[model samples]
Target: MYNGEKRRSSYLMLFIKNRIGTVLIFSVMPLILVSGIILYQFKASHYEKIHAHLGTLVKKHKQNIDSFLNEKLGDIHFIAEIYSFHELGNETFLKEKLETLQQAYGPVFVDLGVVNSHGVQVAYAGPFKLGKAVYSDADWFKEAMKREYVISDVFLGLRGLPHFIVAVRKSVNGDQWVLRATIDFAAFNDLVENIRIGETGFAFILNKEGDFQTKPLMDVIPEKGPYMDLLESDTKEEVQIVEKEDELSGNNIYVSAFLKNGDWLLVYQQKASDAFSAFTKALRVSVIIIILGSIGTIALAFVRFKNMAHHMEKAEHERRLMNEQIIETGKLAVVGELAAGVAHEINNPVAIMVEEAGWIEDLLEEEEFKESENIAEFRRALKQINTQGKRCKEITQKLLSFARKTDSKIQEVQINELIEEIITLSAQRAKFSNVTIGCQLQDGLPVIQGAHTELQQVLLNLINNALDAMEKGGGTIDIKTRLNKDHIVVEIADNGPGIASANLKRIFEPFFTTKPVGKGTGLGLSICYGIMKRLGGDIEVQSVIDKGTIFRINIPLKKYIGEKQDLIM
Candidate 1:
């Protein structure tokens, strides 16, 4: 499209496309930009609030669970530090202490056990019948011996029931011993389970090894979730929120926080669609509105630009017509100047020739040969020269009169007098073309107020066009003037081949030509039409194909049109 080497592109289509693009850029850019910015801010604020709220909930739950475990461990350590190992080793005394603890803390302290340095439960109280149960090689005993205090992940221990321990180790007289207690699994499980949120939200705990420590609300695979990723990522954030697509469930949201001094994780899981449902709905509605608004903007720009282009084309056409009219006016002015010059130059020669012929006739009538034989012939020849020179003088006078008033000053005009001047101007061309120009004038016609040069030009153009049409063969151009009611009417009819019905309608339209190339500019009748209309008059035409054409001009009377008295010049 850039280069016109092989084939040319239609630049009009290019212009239209360019305009459409320009309009869309200016119009739609702001709409999309503002909408996108607003939506982005809304999404950011909404997501920040969600993450903050979930983090707060998870942190609170973590604190309560840690406090519960620490309190239980402190209780056991208090008993170990207060009474001697000998006192705790008595079965009856251990039973009494366990009863006191259960009375204070409810069933959260299920059972108490006293284990010796040799991994044997020296004393047991309540619940199971383990008065003589051995504690060697047990996992809790092994873990309890290593640390001063421990809260372990839930495990099915010797009783074949889900349970975990809060154990405290003490050294007395060079002997190491663990005072351990069993915490109720149902009571600890309630802490994690109660952290539910929306429809698909639930909280659970996982150890460092990706194994569940508390029962979850729904079935979960520990190996295949974003919580596992959060667990391994080792980020320092207190609460981590992640959204990921799941193979079977579409999208899921996971919020995680480290629990139990970074030994386990408290993770809350929910569907992402459920977490930010309000934002999603708002986004959908905004998108719909923007789409509809964009369509409307494009349609409006298209129509507006198309209208502007159409008006521009029409204005260009009118400008060309005006330019042509200016050229026609300049041509008429030059022709009038040339006509006046020729008339002045020819007038002197004809006057001199007429005087010289009279001088010769005077000499022939006088002199020494009053009875000479060639005197009659010479007198006849002198008479002939005198007649032709007088005719030439009259023609030049007519030309000077027509050329003198070529200005557009308003003055009173006699319609018959203008027609007579036009007939005299076109008389020679009519004779050469074998055409005759005839005029029918009625005297005492009322004067019309108009421009003299413009009226003369209109009549002269009609007569000359008639002469051209009949140039191929002889024809008659009849001119008539009359007072028709409240107006003055002039009719110029030609007995030449008339205009076709098709061309007759558009005879007064500018630049609409049916003539051969260079023979016509087609502005004659259009200028005439404009002139008549500007003078508060009208020009009309009627024609048959083979008969003749008649052009009529009507000028409104000044008195009838409520104007001042007509100025007679």
Candidate 2:
């Protein structure tokens, strides 16, 4: 068993050593490598597309906010350029102008005020009571004086609501005044809120100081939001896309654009999972396809290997069977030569002995010894000599007959009668071994066309094997013959310590034996199998350990024409 396993291992190694296995490995490896590359490339391209898309959205919102603020600044410049200070001071005209501005653009501005170069509110229209107020130290006033125009961040003003100031500085007659307007923070909030990024995405504006310029569109403030540091950094890029982990949302993607005029950052943020949903879905599909393709390739390779292994094993089995047959045939040839030689040498002597015995008997029967006292003993001895001599001659003739090879002669023979003859020959051996033999030949069994001597040899071999199996236990041997369809089945079964299941397949292999040394030669069943196969028959055995064994011989009713012609030709 260990040797068999070692041989199998060696065969497997040999198979792997061949180019077929190498080809399989190379093929699969390249497919795996190509798949990996494709997936990586797809992932990179997906993220790039998402980044570009997000960047475009952020830029769009930035333009919208800038356009809104620039429009309001344009309104302030138009009012300052068209109207004089004294005309601006006319409460009714200023109120009319404010109403016209509000009616033209939607109520983005709460009120319009004119502050003198002294930083004092000289005249004002609408909500606040800053008419003729004292000189101011306000940041918007100072920035307006320095930069000619200024837009302030959102703050709680005199009205106690979030609002921002848009101021434009004007000088007439060498006297400077500021045209300042307060825009509704809610209007700015609406603009930012309307720009959507994804399902959870929104836009927010951060002041130059990274402070919220309006109420944030999302739940989290700029200070605590993911990508807060990027928002605060002085990045030179106009638009940037960032990915970060949010404390509340796990992962988030942020797109930020800097507004140069307002020194503000416009940020569009969404959950990473939401923003990359399409990318992730496509990735999953690609991975599944790759996995399925790999499985298919591997399954195909496995099937190919399995088929090749089966063929290789079958070829090896046939080669072994052919070698065994050759050895068995050589043994039979040597045995036949020795048998013919011995029979030829012994036949002449046996014939002469028989003649001499007849002559002695003839002399004894003459009158010379008729009255002898020992005549009866002499006659009996002569009779014994003649009988034994003839027996020797018969034995020699049988040996010569067995040694001679005859052409396969097909004839119609009754299988039942043939089995009866075999049983009779084995009766003495069965009785001597204390084994019971039973025959169950079906009545009116159909005749079969086969070589008589070959069929007889096959049945005789099976009976002998059955008797040998029961020699120790003295069990029962049952020989049965029956006809089924177009074939005749002969089953010889024995209730003895049966052949082991593991050894059953090799029972017909040449030189395989279970008997002790010198008790038996192992070629009987193998020879029987070869003869049956040549005569277009099949031999099969079933066995169970410690129970019994059955050998079934199947022969067709009519000899196979192809096999018969092959044998004769």
Candidate 3:
């Protein structure tokens, strides 16, 4: 029973070694590889597409912001170019012009002022009441004088409201004068406040120094705002996407575009999770599909293994029964051949008996024979007849012994001794075929447990086939035996024309053979294969074309005692 468990374990190992790799390669690996590829492709393309679309949106908004600031600067430049400082000192004309300008382009401008070269506000209109305010050390005044035009960021103005100045400097008669307009900060904020991205998305404007130019839409900004470094750095790219973290949102996605005209940045930001909701959903679906596919593959492999194992078990049982029948048939064939030899052997004794009888009759018929001499001759003849009869009886007994059948009786058998017995039986055929038979039997080999009669039949069939293979070109047959691990191995090798590679795999199948039609029945190797399996052993064949063939038989040294007892019962 322990040996049976070991055999089962070996079979399981063999099955796993053969089938698991195939299952992983054909069924599992492809699914995993394909799923991974799909997920990777989706992630790369989807995010790329999202960033591209966001960049487009940022570009459009950037153009709007740039155009808005450019128009304000153009307004100040147009006034400076059209009106002289002397004319702009006329408050009536300037007030009318400013009112008309405000009515034309919405209420964006808070007021307009003309600053003389002396840095004093010479003329002012609307809102702030700085009639003649000193212009001097203001940053906007200084920048306008240096750059000819300037657009300032949001700051607290004279009106105590957030507003920015768009100013332009003109040289009139070699004297510098500035035309300045203060625009309402609410108008600048309105440009981006109404623009929406997702539920959490908003836009803001930042100056070149990373300071807020417009009122921020969010109340709290994260410590490390997205694109803050880019705004401060010397990066040349005008537009890009930035990933960062926010105080309110864990991860944020920001698309930023730089405005060259105002030296400001337009940033559109949203929560990454919210922005990529569709991609997240798709990823979830793909992960689920991969998991389900993995489970399904494992289940399918398991089912196939179970079905194959069951079928193999059933086939083995059927093969054993069929092998017993083939063994009986082979035994009958051997017995028929032996019958001829036995008849020839018995005929010699019968001829001797007939000769003795004839001699006794002739002595009786002779006239010169006395009573004593006749009696002596008759006794001698009778004795010779008895001896011949005994000889005939011995021959019949040998024939009967050869024909005896024992059904699956298990016993400890010396493998070498068993091979010698089969050799004796096939010696006559081997001689007739001019084949030389030899043995390399290992001494003190382990005894194998199996049915001796069935094993003998297996050997006889193999030896006869070997002899037949070498019949035309007489060759040597080498039978070798050895102890291999826990099994006894027998190798029957013949120097005959070897089997072709294409036909080698089919040799153990029923009705498959390489012999001529009338010369052989193709059941020999198939029967041998089945019988070896029934004996809890295996047979394998190897052949090289034009060289020879070797049939290896491996039989376990120990058989399951319970199984043997069950077979006997």
Note the Cα lDDT for every prediction shown.
0.79, 0.78, 0.77
Location of the lowest summed lDDT over 10 successive residues in candidate 3: 560-569
| Per-model TM against the reference | 0.54, 0.64, 0.51
Poorest stretch of ten by lDDT in candidate 2? 560-569
Residue by residue across 6-121, what tens digits does model 3's lDDT show?
78667866775578678878887888799889888988898898888888888888888888888988987888898888888888888987998899887988788989887899
Give the per-residue lDDT of model 1 (tens digit) for 1-569.
12421222244455567898987788888888899999999999998998888888888888888788888888998998998888988889988999999999888898888888888888888799877677768777788788788787888888898888878888888898878899998988998999988788999999888888899999888887786688887888888888888786668888888877888899988888788887888889889988999889888877776677667656874686566645644554455456558868998888899899999888877767568899989889989999988777765654544345324678898888888888888989999999988888889998888888888988998888888888998899999888888778889999888887568656765545778965775667766765675576767776756678898888887722423321111
- Shift of residue 402 alpha carbon in model 3, Å: 22
Best by TM-score: 2
Which lDDT tens digits does candidate 2 get at residues 373-462?
998898888789888787667655544444443366879889999998988999999999999889898999888888888789889989
The alpha-carbon deviation from the true structure for residue 227 of candidate 2, after best TM-score superposition, in angstroms, is 5.3
Winner by lDDT between candidate 3 and candidate 2: 2
Using lDDT as the yardstick, the better of models 1 and 2 is: 1
